[model samples]
Target: MTIAYWCVLASCLLPLLAVGYAKFLSSDSDPKNYDNNNPRDYLAKLKGDGQRALWAEKNTLEAMPLFFAAVIIAHNTGADQATLDALAISFIGFRLLYIYLYISDKATLRSLSWFAGLACCVAMFIISA
Candidate 1:
């Protein structure tokens, strides 16, 4: 697989990994440990630090489609490998950094990384267009 393909795969997996990590940290080893009594109960349990991690995970997952679309569109438009690789790498790196900073409750750093990832997507979109 090409570097771009690997970047896309890594980008997609980052959020799922974060969510798994968060669940592991919060819940006991038992898979059935989550309380299903109240809907908010589960979400509330993920508050503060856990909540941030959850949000970051959610955001990363949400961004996956747009990232894939941008890359695919770029490929279809005959975008150079270098440009695609650069954008893909930037998107993956920023997304990973964003998740890390968010899980650690580093607001400014997380936001910066999020913006950088978004900017890479925008750059790819523009080039593809």
Candidate 2:
């Protein structure tokens, strides 16, 4: 598979990773009362690191569709594979940094990282055109 395709796979996992991080850090919370079927409420009750992880998961989930669209759209439109691969790889790196920054409570840097990743998606579309 192409690097861009691999990036798509990696991007897909970020939210799951966040969910794990949130749940693990939230061990203190009573799982039985957590409204297991309603994760939003459960995550909302988390504090500190768990809260941070929850938000990171939310952010990653929000970014996933755009990244997927960028990769698929670029490929379908016959954009240069090498260029798309490079941009997609960059997007993955930025997303990783974004997750780390979010977990570390570095809001400004995380926002910047999110912007960079979004830029990558935007560039992919521009390149395809």
Candidate 3:
């Protein structure tokens, strides 16, 4: 309903999007290969952009819970909605940039973008109180 809520949705879905891209580009094109539960086996054939995409997707998933919890805590704790919305948008923006940087092999910029997204998550808590 709110921007923060939508951002949460976006955050939840972004990793899926990244992995979808990676899977589509993987050497194993048949969807049946995905039956394997081992991540190493599932992604063993990925290389270059595909490998980077997989890593980015995993990183985004790892970060998802923190952002989700942070945004919800901020909203429930009566943090300013406008500020929460801004931070939510910033988190998404930075994450998108982080994915792009990673896929493009820009390690330094990707790390900076990662920090910015994490900062946005931290700011949600800071602003809540």
Q: How many angstroms is residue 6 displaced in model 1 relative to the true structure, after the best TM-score fit?
A: 2.2
lDDT of each: 0.80, 0.88, 0.88
Q: Per-residue lDDT for 1-129 in model 3, tens only?
A: 899999999998888777877777554444666645775676767788878989999999999999999998998999999999999999999999998898889999999999999999999999988
Worst 10 residues of 1 by lDDT: 26-35
Task: Give residue 4's error in model 2 in angstroms.
Answer: 0.7
Which is the leading candidate under TM-score?
3
Per-candidate TM-scores read 0.82, 0.86, 0.87
Alpha-carbon RMSD of each model: 3.1, 2.4, 2.5
Name model 3 segments beyond 4 Å from true.
26-42
Candidate 2 residue-wise lDDT at 38: 89
Candidate order (TM-score): 3, 2, 1
Tens digits of per-residue lDDT, candidate 2, 1-129, equal 889999999998988877777875554555566676887787777887778878888889999999999999999999999999999999989988988888888999999999999999999999999
* Alpha-carbon shift of residue 121 in model 1 (angstroms): 0.8
Query: Model 1 reaches what TM-score against the true structure?
Result: 0.82
